[model samples]
Structures are given as C-alpha cells and as structure tokens.
Target: MKVVSSRDFNQDVSHAKRAARIEPIFITDRGRPTHVLMSIENFRHLTGQTETIVDLLAMPEPRDIDLDGSRPTTWDRQAKFG
Candidate 1:
C-alpha cells in the first residue's frame, strides 16, 4: 500500500493511478486518511461484483415489446380487485 497526501495526489494523479494498478493507494487529508485509490478489477473483486459495463451493453435487445396504447374504458376502471 502507498500513502499520498491530497496535495500530492492532486498534483500528480497519473502517479497515483499507476501505483493503484499494483496495490491500494491511501489518500490523506491533513494527515488523516480520507480515500482509497485502486484498480477497477480489485474493487470489483472486493465487492463481489461480477457484471461489467461492457456485459450490460452487449445484452441482446428485446425482440417482443407490447406497445398497446389503448386506454381503459370506464367499466374496466370500475372493476374490483380481489
């Protein structure tokens, strides 16, 4: 793990990101830990999230969609629900 001050993190974001690829980077504010930087893969593994954005985007489009636009009649609206 690497520790970086907020000022240093802001000044060189690329360096923090590079270090995150290998391990978690702890960002501190006023000598107190505030945030953590890590690769997306590590985050997903830690959170147990398996689906990626790419997987969601690659899903097949719905083939059958009900587009009926008819409005309910007054009698239909008055029907009781069990």
Candidate 2:
C-alpha cells in the first residue's frame, strides 16, 4: 500500500496514477486518509461486478430467460371474489 497526500497527488497526478496501477494509493487530506486511488481492473476485481446489462444482452442465447410467444390472456372483470 502506498500513501500520498492530496497536495502531493494533485501536484504529481501522473506518478500517483502510476503507483495506483501497482497497488492502492491512499490519498490523505489534512494528515488523515480520505480517498483511494487504484486501477480500474483492481476496483472491478474488488467489487466483483464487471458485467453490465448491455454485456448480458450481448451474450449468445442465454438459457435462463423465458420468452412468451403468445399474447397474455385477458382477465375476466365480471367474476368477483371476496
């Protein structure tokens, strides 16, 4: 883990970004930890959420989806139940 003050990070964003690729870079404000900088891949790996709805839809022939080919049956309004 690498720690960088907000001022330093702001002054040298390229270096901080480069360091982030290797590991998380903790950004501090007023000598206190405030944020983290990390690669997108690492963030995705940590969050365990990489796929989007568009990606799922783009998949070939998903098995779980049920497609209703017929029109929905109309409800009978005359029938009443308490």
Best by lDDT: 1
- Candidate 2 lands at a TM-score of 0.61
Per-residue lDDT of 19-54 in model 2, one digit per residue for the tens?
999999999999999999999789989999797898
Candidate 1 global CA lDDT score: 0.90
Candidate 1: which pairs clash? none
9-74, model 1: which lDDT tens digit per residue?
Answer: 999999999999999999999999999999988999999999888978999989875468464545
- Candidate 1 TM-score over all chains jointly: 0.64
Please state every model's RMSD to the true fold in angstroms.
11.5, 12.5
Candidate 2 achieves a global lDDT of: 0.89
Q: Quantify all predictions' global Cα lDDT against the true fold.
A: 0.90, 0.89
Error of 1 at 19 (Å): 0.5
Per-candidate TM-score against the hidden true structure: 0.64, 0.61
